[model samples]
Target: MTITKKQITFSQAINDAIQTAMAIDKSVICYGLGVTDPNGIFGSTIGLEEKFGSQRVFDIPASENAVTGVAIGAALDGVRPVVVHQRSDFSLLTLDQMINNAAKWRYMFNGIHSVPITNRLIVGRGWGQGPTHSQNLQALFSHIPGLKVIMPSTTYDVKGLLLSSVFDDDPVIFLEHRWLYNQVGLVPEGDYRIPIGKAKIINKGEDITVVGMSYMTIEALNLIAVLSENKISCELIDLRSIKPIDSKCIIDSVKKTGNLLVLDTACKFGSVASEIITLVVEECFSYLKQSPRRITLPDFPVPTSPALTSNFYPQDLKIMEVISEMLSKKINHQKQERPPISMHDIPGDWFKGPF
Candidate 1:
């Protein structure tokens, strides 16, 4: 599938995608905070109310849990509902509705009920929003058993993933990075859908496999360019869908590259990164040449100051540094583990973590 190069901002691409879906499917309804009212905060859903009418695109009360529960109920009754949470941090309010109700309804109902609901969340860091507003909670949703978690970094993925999410029978948590909304990219002119539970290989390389999602995917792309300039070829995998992850792609990439680096914006501990790393090690341990390293935000709460936040959040430079160190260690290990290599010959730190 070839995508034409046409410039468009991320937010505009998302809006166009939703509008296109609504035009074709009357059951597709969008509702959330400031989405249908006087101020559509990001303008992603602006003018949608006019075209779709108030019934399809309307605003709800300032209750995240209630709004999500309403969407879940509608979805059960055959309505493809898209519930938007203005901020990712606010999704905490709907945990019960999401995890217990929406996620388990189908199993609890013996497959008679399906939750075809899409919960759109905006994740942002820095910009002086403080700890509360700047949290990246994709990992939290990804941990749930029945939810499909998607965090697209590019405008193309945003449109394709959202379109796919609308059609999926299971509940989907679509995370949009607030920082990438204005960033421009070329998207196909017509309706399209990128398959859910698929990973895209952004760059081909032989050295290390870097798995990233959401805005961190873009950061990984940038680091890949820099690493290439230094003669370090890195295979980049965009985990577009966090849940029902494309483990085959990751395993294959690690088998070829012999090293892995899982990068994420979520906290370092108990994050999606840990899950990815676990999968790679468990499935492709023999293929790995060195320990898998993860570049992620510190476990502490997000700081308010720009300088402090920058240090707390995982960035391109930090990723590059970690990758370089891993590569160096791999080279040294290969030299030591020659001919009759034993388990002890392999680096001890490589097996420290479970994954």
Candidate 2:
């Protein structure tokens, strides 16, 4: 049961996934903006072109729609094309190919064709990237029927889930938060594939259930210390895949805890948070002690200034605030020990250089 492991950053895990997949399958290819650049899409695609050669790992232009179309076409021809987007905010331009073409091909064509493509869209923030660049738009793609939507929170999950997405027959939407690029964790040395639709229960408890999606999972982990101090036993679930979210796991956790809190990077309406709440309401309504609460950004444009952004993005403190309010405990605004992480534009100080 033992396995070898090595510590790696989230970005390096992503790079490792691509490298392994390309090495195993001749039909696998990686392309998109900055795939060949020095920064390498925040270093996830670092040195891919040099290692795999430009024919397999290369860059494309700003033609979102065109790039998607070509990738879809290539996928139809029995190639697995990994398309990278610098920012999920700008991926809106490629909806036609994503939603209509790639997402519906198998059903529309009577299962004659399969588009086994992986779309790696990097969600941006910090440095006042503003409304157009800082948005998390996984909800848009998760709504599509044929695509597999994933937002991995750890280095282990990133590599495994990316491997799963690469080998699967349908198109996959792989979301990576900019802040998570520097986060490090243990990753297996060999190939490992986590199931696409499964959710991981991070902590088991009885007081309440907290669901953290994408980067918010990291924040939730940080709030563990504060929650434990208050004797709030939290059952934390990481919703790794958004489309076919592990609803059964979420419902079971809610049933045990009798309270639910969802922390997501997107707005509440029609979001991953809303969808989880809907599942709980439909199947475990009677198990609730309190109404499910969702903590997410306002359904509006992200602020552009550093000062505005400090208050704009909710972090560990905000999660603690929401938890205390939900449990009817006195707000620990001043009493709580502040999180060790500095309040900054990005998560880490390692972001000084490119990527």
Candidate 3:
């Protein structure tokens, strides 16, 4: 049980994961725009070129579609490629290759070949990134078959999950919250892989079950502290992997607690939150003490104005309010003492960014 644990930032953990993968496997290559630069896409790709040389770690042109096609070709040829995109918004250009080619090649060929491609997509809100710069389209990406989609909220997860995604046999859309970049947590040194389709319970309670994805997981953890004071004990489930969500973990928790609240980054009609809630109602409905619920961004474009953006994303107070309604308890409407929110539509002050 005794193992070393050292605190590291989320970005550094990703860097460590890529480095570890490259060190063990010569087939692993890291390439993307500005991947070899000094900032290194928030430092995840810094020093990669120096260690692995230009051929394996150099930058690519602004041609997203062509770059993705090339990576797919390489992966089919047995090279593991990790492609980094500075923003998820622009990765839309590569969706045709991702959805049609990378995601469907193995099945089309009757399982003779697989694309072990890892696309590192930086997602979430920060620094007024606005509609064009910030978006978490996990639901859209996860909808396609033969693709693995994961959103890691912690540094430990950032490292282990990146390693897992790199070694995975199918295309993996690794959606990372840029806001979680500076969050520090203990990570086991060296190579380790968290199983791709599992969920982790960050806080255990019996009154209600709250499943939070990506940054919402962090917000759920924060909200739990306040909910506890009002005698509301909640079970917090962080769905690290989105596509093959750990229904077992969520169902088990909801069965015990009999209450469910799903929180996610986007507001798709049939979103991650909707699917999880539907799963609980279908399977764990008999155990329900309260109706299942969810909180998500409005089904609209993200606002660029910081003033308008403050209310665009979900918040802890929103969770608290939702919980209050579920419990049939009144929330305090009076102006109360609370710290100011520095980052709107984002949780945790973990981002130290130039983006």
Model 1 pairs in collision = none
RMSD of 2: 1.9
User: Each candidate's lDDT (Cα)?
Assistant: 0.83, 0.87, 0.87
Comparing candidate 1 with candidate 3, which one achieves the higher TM-score? 3
- Expressed as tens digits, the lDDT of each residue in 230-322 for candidate 2 is 788899999999978898899899989899999989876788888888889999999999899998988888887779888777888888877
Worst lDDT 10-window in candidate 3: 345-354
Per residue, candidate 1 scores C-alpha lDDT tens digits across 246-298 of 99999999999999999888888889999999998899899999889998888
> Which residue segments of model 1 deviate by more than 4 Å?
1-5, 37-39, 329-355
Off by over 4 Å in 3: 330-354
Q: Which parts of model 2 have CA positions greater than 4 angstroms off?
A: 331-343, 352-355
RMSD of each: 10.0, 1.9, 2.2
TM-scores vs. true structure, each candidate = 0.90, 0.95, 0.94
Cα shift from native, residue 54, model 2 (Å): 1.3
TM-score of 3: 0.94
| TM-score leaderboard ranking | 2, 3, 1
Which pairs clash in the backbone of model 2?
A: none
